[model samples]
Target: MSQLRRILVDAFETEVALRRVFLWLPAAAGAGVVSYMAADREPSLWLLVPLTAAFAGLAFLARGRRLAFFLLCGLCAFFAGDLSAAWRSARVAAPIIDRTTIGVVEGFIEQMDFRRAGARFVLRVHAIEGLAAAATPYRVRLSIHRAPPFEAGAYVRLKARLLPPAHASLPGGYDFAKDAWFARIGGVGNALGRIETAAPPAPPGLALRTMMALDRGRNALARRIDQIVGGDAGAIAAAMVTGKRDLLSDAAKDVIREAGIFHIITISGVQMTLVAAIFFVGFRRLLALSPTLALRYPIKKWSAALAMAGAVFYDVATGSRVGTERALFMTLIMLGAVLLDRQALTMRNLAFAALIVILTEPESIMGASFQLSFAAVAALVAVYEARMAAAAADREDGLILRARAVEGERLRLFWRACKNLLARGPGGLLFATFCATAATASFMAYNFHELSPYVLIGNPLTLTVIEVFAVPGALIGTLLYPLGLDAWVWRYVGLGIDGIMWAAAEIGRLPGATLHLPAFAPWSIIFLTLAMLCSVLWRTAVFRAMALPLAVIGVWGALCGPSFDMAVAPNGEAAAFRGQDGRLAVIASRPSLFASEQWLRADADGRPAREAVKKDACDKVGCVGYLADGRSLSLVFDKAAFAEDCGRADIIVTPLFAPAGCAAGLVIDRDELKETGAITLLFTASGVARRAARTPDEDRPWSPAPRRKWGPSSRPFAASRPTRAASSDLDPSSVARAAGEAPGSVEDEDGDASPLE
Candidate 1:
């Protein structure tokens, strides 16, 4: 009895400590690392080294408790893994000669890329031709043009120009550079006519053929389903089945986006959770039915193993990076628990899973999918564990036992079961969704500087449907596969999804479905994360209550923060060509790329909105009038362009290069004025004002001295502060009069007058 007591006490103690570590330590350490990255001027690796040593010491000192030690080690390892991955990426990226023509390119196609011109593929390059001196080979993204009809599995070789990824000139453009970097894609381009099919055999040991075969089958089924459902239904169904959302139409996608159901587009947590639950329930039932099998072996253990196998198959079929990683990590945990004959929900399992994934691919740790997936799982596990602990504590108090007759005990158990179900199911799902959305929003806001206000509603609905559908669909797909009816099954599934799409579209069309919140401040996300952490970690009711207020404050900050669209000068003088909705508006100055493109992609980072606000031909340099969703924002190339039909111009912006006669009313060119010997003035109307220049005899507080050299091409001088029309009509030599002062005055500077040559 004493031995048993000691074992129970040890198990309980270890479990509690492990819980504290996994549930809380990660957030603490993550905070520290992120803080260090932000605050330190000259980052000291030694600071982390000490922390690393301390973690290692903690692991070693906790002798009998292997789980706690492994967790600490895992946390430290993740930190190290992040640094290593970043370092390696930097090293590999540094040596590659930019614009070098000679490099041996080799890699299989990662995925089929559909472009307007033709079907291309994203090739993962292994080598470059001329730069053999560069030891480490980084992956390059190649766009194969005019490919001989190819599917995702096909392998081809192409000699193409490797250019650096494009950067956003303005704030809101998508940073392909960052995305490509994380994806380990170093270059992107089309084939240069020399293309060949180099169908390489699958690698020796890994599950390449099996994975490919599964992918091919899934794709084939999806295509057939697409054919059956046709159009939007087919696209939605294909996405549901194979996790391929690229086929979805803009209208269908917009509906999903507005409904906050875009999470359904990705097969990760929803599918995995359902898969695990089904296996757990089905296997428990099977064991109950068969006493002989139940007595001999642990049915739950076998169920977990089978569940893992299903997850593996599901991941391969989808090939979503996040899904694959999460499924693999979770499966590893289950498999490890099975081998140890331990409960799968322990802190050790989560740690081991995290360690495996980080050690394999550290870059994934930084991605939104990984962060959100782990956050949801962590939140769920923590919530469940807390409930179990509370129940156990209640039992230990004996107050419940003293009051319980047989009927009373039965009622108590029923109530406790109900509580557990509610806590772990609906409550847990909601909390998990909340945490994930918060974290993702924060990350996106910091990176893209924009927030989709509808996500609060969108994600929950989407995740709920996904959770409802993913498992049932996977199971039905598998069951029907053996009976040669999977295709037929998916055909109906496609039809059902199409109906959902219609509903979502209707929802999107409703008034104010998507509220566009400007990019958030950094501290807003930080405080929000803090509030979320407090809610999860704090035990006292008073402390927990604080989380709500903090969350509200954080959200308020996010909603009313500095917009990335506006470029403000250091002195607080700022300008933006912005729509009333706070989106960038059309300007006469350097054509606003994003303004012209009707569809703007909001980056989560607190950066400028660099994507096109409209998808019109206005992406290029030219005057354009954007008409999308019944709203028009016009731009004129000539000086002082007019919008006849539209309402009064909400905001007028002039590029620095706007013709001398052009009047935009507001000019955003602080840098241009600082660099060039020119001063821009903004007034209520088109006008010219002249102030006498300070002479040497007249003392001035702070003034720039006038300097001059002979004109590069001397011409006859025309003296005057030219009117808009005079300036517009002036010869090149005469235009130089205002700067150096000409001999004769020739024109009038009238206020609010139209500048027509």
Candidate 2:
């Protein structure tokens, strides 16, 4: 077993690899970022800053001993990462919109992202009608549904409905508001009617002007590609060249997603590597034609430099997303290695790129893009390194003719070499596919709640087309566009796009193509990540031994964690209760489409929102539903139903105020939810447990406490009716029974202070 493991797991270690201590810096720094994110409250920099500096200085001083130096350096990286995240959070802090508002909006369009059905515009806001100057947001994003989409740098005035950034739909769900805070977006909304262009209050600044000009140029190219392709094929072709996926048809998107080869359209490692490779080889050959010049100067370094420039150009032309930037940085590092005559394709280069990305964008560590990209690369490199060390693989590649061989023997050798080539053709591609898919499956499931079983069929088919024609076509088209001769290039590229789309559609339609998964505990991914790194990074027996157990623990936790019995939206706009069939059935007076969708996906339920509604006893005043554990839940809309619900139900939830002394086992009201944010309840043999999306206990900047109502104060009014029960009228025995405790069973040291039940 150990011998088999050693062959497959790359235990071939070099002294150089073992001594590269900086390889671990990115991991340590990432750990620090995670620690900061998981904290319930903000960290104090004044207390942490000096301590971090001192620890780093200590690491610097411990240079003589290699082991101690590595340990201390790792600690320093961790501390620096934590401090970096905190500092970034503080620096990006800005005013957030408090409530929904409907009015005219005037702003300069900073960005425009078009979709097939609609477009989203990010604006640098100048004013919102009727809002106080202090309350105006610095920026807002609006979904434009009407025609005549505005371009970047255009000033527009339009009426719209704007809302504050929202919290998670349920506990441990994705937090859009937190992401928006980092992006410096204060609000999001939908625009109404046609957009009206207006004169700018002032000219755009030099930096903004430059960026907008570049965006306009790229968008023009994307549009031209779309025009030539003329269908869903065109949309995909445009995306392949420009990374603008908004124009994709729904069918195309579904097929690509199910096929699990959507990364081809995105500006990721594959795209970057192709562009750089083309430029590097093309320029090197071009330079080498002049032997006199080639011998006098370093043509390889010159090629690498041009390759780096080409990569940077591709990155910016394709929107410069965080994932693309990461790819560009890694590509640049590899090219730089060529210049220095060092081994370019190694783990050390990957580590250096990761470290640079972490220090520059610490917040990016939390994003799915960063995690997925890095994970796939790490797995591929590990497998490649392992294969390189195998003796058989070398012997197969070393097959050649000997000078002493006779005619018949030479013929035999030629056929033998042909057989080896045929055997390697499909085997190598399949192996690489397995390695990348296995490494990214858990994270993909965790993020999208779905997996593609046909990726094995899909990746090989689509990737070939992408490599042979699609990428090269885009590259040629982009380079020749300024000459007005690129239309022919795009027409050929469309044929490759058609092939890819056909493969995606057919493979995606196969039975069991997509598998839905329930959301797992967030910490499970951490364990899984550690397992991957341990198995791939080090060639030692001890590290290899640690990998399997950690992976098992992660998979167990992800698959076996407790599920929510019931859930309520943050603002009490939508609520859901789980039925006996283990499916969520929503119950709400004013339903929220976004919240319902999130809940269904998280629960791994594929039913539509309408079909998923709970068929409970309901009327205008209230509704009653039953839990799997035989508990009755009552939702009261009117104050009239509260009196009856508070008495008969196991739990009472209402927007109206319930009178004191209700005998229900639990009471959840609007005021309570306002403080708790969204919450999920878990019912067990012992009792009921609640998990809130955001509790009063946590004080993160993105999730500030609810603000008080604004306006002039009013005098309190007294109710004349005396029929309802008042405060301090509770019956001790009834309340105790509701709490599942005998009345006055326990004694306290002070008789006057029996703990309030």
Candidate 3:
């Protein structure tokens, strides 16, 4: 019987070795799918999938056991990659029924965007009630008519059509629809009134409502905390507790982004891992304190179980998204290991984690968090296992030489222990962190152009602190949680986090802390991913060393390769060039103050253009030119064009309408000039004719004229073309006044200049 069992075990092992090539097939497929989905111009070569699948199947049949296992790994990786696209597509196609009149909407605000004069938000509406398009709620990314003071939880109703969020018009541009879909947000809008008391209907048979309730409660708590502490500290505290970061102003957000410490506010891997580790350590320590209990049962095992419970709670508290999912999977595996009397950090455990993640949320397969966390774990496991195997071989060789020598056995055990410690020690931890950060950063750079230069420094320091502080704090928090003192402990924890926040902000201020790159190309992302995969897989020392540096350089080159920073004006015209400070500027022939302000605010990092102009005029037409400072733009307009002479505008721009003789410069028709994508002006007659439609021809021509005399600088410039000029040089206060006096008008800036200001 024993011999048969051994034979069967050996046979099973052989079968695994033989069939393993198929495992990687999913990974390969996922990768292919991801590539296909992320394609700027989706290829018509989908027929290649079937061919590849057939080829892979043929290869699997031809390969030996080792090759089969390798193939299996590829398959798994392929499937994981496909998850992003599948989830994204599902979200876009599935529309939540938003009952606009019923005042009920379900979904989350995926992100915020820029609006004309206010702000635009994208909501991934899961379900909506009392709306026209409730069958499958298509997305309705709402542009807030006015700037509403709100955050992710600020529920609102909209009296607008639900339109699909904009897609990437150009290749490799940010896809808003996909982003919103992946986030499960269906629409975006402002609050109907103040967030009145309302109950959003629950999704079918899911814990979404319960999770949302907790989120709302946490949001309330964060609001209260924000009120208690002002500035960054307050924002950090609120972020730590409730994960509400929108409470911070735009300036604060920019500061954090620049500093590269913005991740702390988001519920991320650090938070989940910290909380779990603390629970485990604390519970273990408590059990150990009770000597009798410790002696009777394994304390570490109990501690692991207790820690898992805490992780479960944390998952519930946070809504069990990607971060929570990863933590829960990790905690469960750890607890399972303790229960099963096996090693936690093994390849089997990694497989288990993968299975758990996929089973729980198939959508997570393509998520960066899932890929990064698992990849890092897998790498660590493989490396550790290989080292163990090497040590075992060394010990076996020594045992053969020593022939039952006690000294040799003792030495071997000691060396093994040392090797194990070395694998997980501070240096190893730092290396692991660096690798993970690099991996995640690469992935993000591919998806989002924003990459922090400070990560090289920030990640190590921040992770070290998190590693040191998290286990202890989490233990304390979990211990106190049972004793009804969790809140008090977290308060103190908040204090510690505040210190961390201070340090992060300080370090983030260092030079080279931030680097904004142009959006990545799909092919660049593919190449970067390939580089990482190669670095991870190359087993030879020389090959690995060579690969690592090459990969880094390659990724850097890909990131810094090209730029697409074109800014489009509200009128659907593209801005010609970036302003002096590298900002987009727009020149409007008849700039409505509100419209200019909207474009400026959206184009600017979140500041409005009106404040820089120093005026209140929302007259008929306004000319908005880029000021030298990237932060500000000047508005040029005519007072008579509207009705009231509201004294607002950095400078007024007017056409040169010379009646006595022909104007010195070329005359431009505003509409025709706008079409040329240049700064050209309309003739006095044409300008007056167009004005007649709005006002009456009897009313006066709005263009102010100096006739080379007493008024403002009447430079004889043709209104026929666009001209680029320094903001410091041009003033149009007199041109605005001249437009009201007579039929003649004066040109503002030179022709042939871009209307982009």
For each candidate, the alpha-carbon lDDT, in order, equals: 0.49, 0.74, 0.47
Considering TM-score, which of the candidate structures 1 and 3 is the better prediction for this target?
A: 1
Query: What TM-score, to 2 decimals, does candidate 3 have?
Result: 0.60
Q: Give TM per candidate.
A: 0.64, 0.84, 0.60
Q: Mind giving the per-residue lDDT tens digits that candidate 3 earns over 1-757?
A: 9996776556545535634323334346546566645443323325444544655575577566655546554654554444434443443455532222234554554334322245445554555555555464544455454655554444444434343332222233333334444444443333343333234354323353454456555555555555555566666666655555555665666666665566666566667767877778878887888879988987888888888888888776654666557657766887778878987765555555655565445545555656656665555555676567777886677667577666647777677668667866866666665665665666665544456766655566556545554435445554564465556545554565666666667866786665545444345655666565545544434334545665666667675543322332212222212456655444544223333333333232334443433233223454344434322222223333322211222222333221212121222222221122123111242321111111111111111111243453323333343343333332345434434322111111111010100
List residue ranges in candidate 3 displaced over 4 A: 1-29, 39-92, 96-163, 192-208, 220-230, 281-306, 347-430, 444-457, 464-491, 542-560, 564-576, 579-757
lDDT tens readout by residue for model 1, 552-652 = 98888777654333332111112233345544433322323332231233322222234422334243322333222222333322222322211232222
RMSD of 2: 9.6
Top-TM-score structure, candidate number: 2
Q: Write down the RMSD of all candidates, one decimal each.
A: 12.8, 9.6, 13.9
User: Which candidate model has the greater lDDT, 1 or 2?
Assistant: 2
What lDDT does candidate 1 reach at residue 488? Answer: 62
Candidate 2 error regions (>4 Å): 1-17, 130-134, 391-424, 480-485, 587-593, 607-667, 706-757
Query: Which pairs clash (backbone N, Cα, C closer than 3 Å) in model 2?
Result: none
